[model samples]
Target: MTILQPQVGHETLELLTNVLIGNGFSIGISSQFNYSSLVELCDLNIIDKKLFEELETSNFEFVMKTLVNADKLDKIYNRTDSTFLHAYGRIKRSLIEAIGKIHPEKYEIDLSDNYVLNKTMVRHSKRIFSTNYDMLLYWMILEDKKHVDFFGRSHNKDGTLRFTPNRESEKQVFHLHGALHLYLNDGYIEKLNTSDHLANHSSIVELIKEMIELGRMPLFISEGNGEEKKKSILNNEYLNFCYKSLEDLEGSITVFGHSLDNEVDSHIIHALNNAKKLSRVNYCIYTEGKSEPVIQLEMSRITYLFSGKEVVFYDSESIRNNMRVIEFYV
Candidate 1:
């Protein structure tokens, strides 16, 4: 009953780029709009060009603070047509598109083998919890004709939601953070129409510009304490859902791309720690060998507090070249 949760970010993109380029997608796709930056970034990485080190001083607390203080993000978004949120969404969509265009068959097979097939054989339900605001996962899952099983039917803030992908009719995803495709109207979370792609309309861009002129908010985390833990992210539903998840006797839970930097998310670490006490809880932290230092540091910190179970570090290069997510089950 292994539970694998892959983080979808730079690490994912890096490996995926190799997969795409190897499959014969054009490097600089002129047909794709606003693809210049994506092509440039992908080109530089694929060509083995040197990339500047990101400011190493940045840490979880720094980013958490920025997310909580929406005003800071607002200010940044105001000046530029591109809000941090928009950029984040764009990256997610582009990565999925790039992957879909290149090895669509491989992508579908891997997902099915890794999650759905594994769950059926093990007799343990599959549950996917993600913090990404993008719909890439949704799109991928839909293509497979699978729906998520959220824990509870309660729409209350205090109610907890747990899910078994096999029991989707009973439960569904409990989006802790707001989703990009969801809009808050009249204090309710409603799904936006799929047709509203905002194709160069710049309404968001103009709206953001006006916000910046009026000193509006930023949509991302730049730096500060994630004090919004109690009311916002750590609300009742989140806490209870986490508790329920930890209680489940599922086997190893593979954490893919998440940084586990949020102070509010310390609860997840705590839950994992507790799970390890009851059974063997193995961690598969994936990363390019070069970025092992950061993941190692995080592992050390969390492991120090949780010494009851085994924590394994799986490097990407070791598996990336010959890796298929499906291989984990077989």
Candidate 2:
């Protein structure tokens, strides 16, 4: 198969943009290189040099499993320091703080120019799925509140939140790996309203910190292994809902900012293969000036994953440039 060139021309980009704006198309976002900022923040604030060295030396999956499930492990492994648990808490806090710092208001000025593209592009998408725990998508939805509805949880007349599926909305967002704002309440995943922050003068970070201090960790899944990540999703009601939504999606799906790491994303491949009405798959490749051979190898993996379907490729940079222009106009 011939290696495809980046979608850089105006006509090609316009076509892809139009397809994105059309109904029946779904989108998947992952934490790729674009999230280096968040990674840097976590590295600095959550993991110190010595602890980072220790983490690098140890098996990440084993450490995380020990941190979260030490009770199930043999008593010999559970030390008095509870170092793994403490590390887990710190990591969780860093993630929440990093995401909270970038709250929607922080980009209020840029929203007029930057978010219009997001709002318009996602307006007609059937469902938006994200593997990230950040609030970037949530902020985008807040920007286009009238057009987008999210799946998972909602409030009832009795003032209690419930986890109910809402498929009636034309545009829906699903957090496949959970979000910073979601928490477990009374055995159910419930969303925290942004408004609630003012009543107690507590920020999202504070709320998350409070949860961790009280021995209840936030529901963010960051399993280091693919099988473990899949298991975590299957075990969580909200995550499972998001996974099923992806599996049930009909028509084409566009993936952006996702490395599609085979081990961590096998479930995504399975969903694409099993989707009943999927006819095409479009992957946005972020080359970052890599050589052709490297790009070709990446494309080949995607081609193999969607062997029988019509596979299309888009350049991430080209899409960003086009969106920048769209932002200025709309």
TM-score of each: 0.43, 0.69
Error of 2 at 172 (Å): 0.6
lDDT of 2: 0.58
Q: State model 1's lDDT.
A: 0.36
TM-score of 2: 0.69
In Å, residue 226's CA in model 2 sits off its true spot by 2.3
Tens digit of per-residue lDDT, candidate 1, span 25-82: 1111112222322223332232121211132212222322333354466776675443
Worst 10 residues of 1 by lDDT: 18-27
All candidates' lDDT scores?
A: 0.36, 0.58
Q: On residues 1-330, what C-alpha lDDT tens digit does candidate 2 reach at each position?
A: 442344434443433321222111112222221333343555444354355456542222234445667534534765566655666667656655655554333233344543455555554345677776655565567667743334333455644345677646655777777766676766767665556544674455456556545554456664445665777789888888878887877767777667677886777677668887878877777677698899999999989888978888877556655665554554
